[model samples]
Target: MIPLRQLPRLLRIAGVLARHRVDELLPASRRPRSLAWLRALMPAPGADLLVLPRGERLALALTALGPIFVKFGQILSTRRDLLPADVADALTQLQDRVAPFPAAQARAAIERAFGATIEARYASFDDAPLASASIAQVHAATLADGREVVVKVLRPDIHARIDADVALLRALAGVVERTHPSADKIRPQAIVDEIETTLVNELDLQREGANASLLRRNFAGSDDLYVPEVVWSHTSAGVLTLERVRGIPVDDLAALDAAGIDRVALAEKGVRLFYTQVFRDNFFHADAHAGNIWVDATRPADPRFIALDFGIMGSLPERDQYWLAENFLALFNQDYARIAELHVRAGWMPADARLDELEAAVRTVCEPYFTRPLSEISLAEVVVKLFEVARRHDLTLQPQLILLQKTLLNIEGVGRLLHPRIDIWATAKPVLERIWRRRSGPRAVLRTLRRRVPEWLAAAPDMPQLVHGWLSRANAGEMELRVASDDLKEIERRLRHGQRVAIWLSAGVSLAVATACVALLAPAGAPPGARWVAWLLGAAAVGAFALAARRS
Candidate 1:
């Protein structure tokens, strides 16, 4: 239940929705009867609004609500499969272009963050904003050393506003989870949590600066991408200062032509850079919308991408990274069986799901796309189809990967916009294959072993005691095993044999360590006592190994 403190805001939201006639979007059966009285009490929308499309009205209402709601709309826009085409299209137009707060307020925020006057910090600071967004506004400024930079200042009291709205959203999500029939599929609470995490990360400018710095370091000397340097001395949590950069917007094709830029090469580079960031570097700029991406025209023949807005960088967990890379390769190869197996092995699908059925379902959905020209196939659509198939097979989608999915869509959109004939599969396959080869090769195994051996050796001494305790407990009848079937009984038998092998191996390793210690620490002029101790340890090591070999 929503608290009394949130009731007013709840009513405000209901009123906004009603005014926009969003209730009409829902069937009468699904609409709550309780909201009827409230709708009657609220003021009606203007006639101008009544003439607008329902989707546009909804978008406008969300914009009227605040940045948090607008952000929610932005996230929803990416999931075209889940929403009506018109609604998703309308939401795609929802950009982060809100009116800027007063210059005095921005100045006050900067002063409070740094505890210094604006004049003391910069040589000249512009009062008018260069660009204004929902959470922050960017102002052009010059450093004391005459370097130009852009100063981004967070909106005043944004945290309190975000906190209050987030609490309201959580309450609403709980209500929907309890009441909505499709709550499991919608996962409203998880979506709210994702929005909250994204907002919280974006709220910290210092963290964003670090992200920009790291991305810059990763692409240092690279011809494909350029990241602006962060000005640490002038940056803080509430304010960020980055080196100023200017380039043609990536979506501006006419400008590219005017500048004699190679659009085809530029588009191919975007695809390659995206795969490099995700698979090779494992760190990618999640928000790669046109505004944040610009093309450097100075090198018209060899263009580079200038990235902006470091607030929403993304990285996958190691397991997800590997599985996703393999999944892409499987899709590229049209290996539906491998795709099905991967989904199950990655724990995305239920273990009991029949692989043959899953493979058939995937082939049905994806095989048609292959009939089309390679350039005509949309990678985003293929991913969406995979997700649809996953839903049918009881797929457990990871909340953490939503960012990567969104990034993929953005990259594809940009790539197609730059060069409609670009084959994303062809461009990305080589990058993934190269990464897979590097990661799974013999040298990689050797590197991993070198890094892990010390840790294993340090823990070797404890294994003998642990294994002995387990065996003693089993022999004492303190451990019980109940098998429900012949398969389980066979598994139990194998487990017992494995335990015995573990015990022998542990004893062997422990004795070996003791022998090594005795030999390494013994006196050079072998005193009889020290020599005997060394001999005993060596003998014990040999005996333990012999026992282990016999047990196996």
Candidate 2:
């Protein structure tokens, strides 16, 4: 439950949602009349807002809420398989079309970011926005060198707004964990922490610029994709400047046709680009919605992709990358058994998970698709189905893979929109095979060894001395050899326990023997009481020895 102080914000959220009639997701007859009084207090929306579809209204409400909600909607929009079709379609607009902060405020943010006048910073700067999104807005500008660039200014008060929304979400996550029956499996807190980290990283424009720079370096000479160059002199923690780029938006089919662009080739390239980035380079653009992607149609015969918004890039650990590549290859080969084995080896499935059972499950899900048209195949859908099957066996899902999943969904979405006939498997196999060769081949081993030679050489001179000392000690009576055996630990524990019991048993026996000797050697004048005491002591010693023996 939220504190009393946060009720107003929560109430405001409810009111805004109610005003937009978002509650109509449930039947109107289901709502209590007590809520009508609160609804009556809200101003009536115009026909324009009311006439729009339910999904649009919901998207608008989230946008109005702020960047945090916008981010949530953006992530939600990617999981079309799990969402209502209309809502998923409408949510794409939230990607980079959220209501932007004012232009004048944007100017002040830019000035404050650079600590200089606009005229002094750029030879020409437009007050009008070229593009606007929840986190930032871009303006056209020209440098002193007559180079065109776009200035990205972070919206003012974004940090505070994000902080507030995150706090509210954290509170909600806490409530969910406490009340929701499936909280442990869902891991709401862990989800929120990931969201928090991503959102916080996005707030720093310098970090985004760095991401863009690294991506640019990765594809410096590549013609398949182009990343805009960052203008370091104009970039800051709150503002980013990159070379102005123009391309046909990926979704604009009419423009693409008009430019004589090859849609089929473009789609194939998109698939290849995704695979190469993920398996080959181990980095990919996680946020790949249409709004941040475009196609360079400068040459109608050839089309290249243009990527923007480097805030969220995905990378996998070397182990995952290798396994994921093999998984893809396995899928391409229709090797269900290989896929099942890989899943088990990767710890995705439980240790005791039956490989044959998993293989049968995968075959049931994928065999029909193999004979179907390539155009109808969705890589994302296949992976999702596999995940569902694995869940039946209690799969341990990795959080790091979520970003890759989202990115894969985005890639498939773009590919489907551009060319429905594009064969993702055909496009990805060669790339995966090449990556596999480079990963485990002899050349890879040589490269690894070359990198490690210096460290090995530094320790090589001590190897002979260490071995000689071991031999010398072994040759002498002082040698103590320790063998590596799994049973040694258990044996050592039992030996120590038996040693303690033996000491007690020996003491008890000795006491009894001494008592017997004293009794036998006593003078004839000894008191009857002393003899009774000796007999009692002997009985006690026998009891102690028996106790020790029983314990041992």
Best TM-score among the predictions, by candidate number: 1
* TM-score list, all predictions: 0.86, 0.78
Model 2, residue 552: C-alpha shift (Å): 30
Supply candidate 2's per-residue lDDT for 466. 66
Best by lDDT: 1
Lowest summed lDDT over 10 consecutive residues: which window, candidate 2? Answer: 474-483
Model 1, range 221-260, lDDT digits (tens) per residue? 9999999999999999999999999999998899999999
- What is the clash count for each candidate, in the order shown? 0, 0
lDDT of 1 at 23: 77
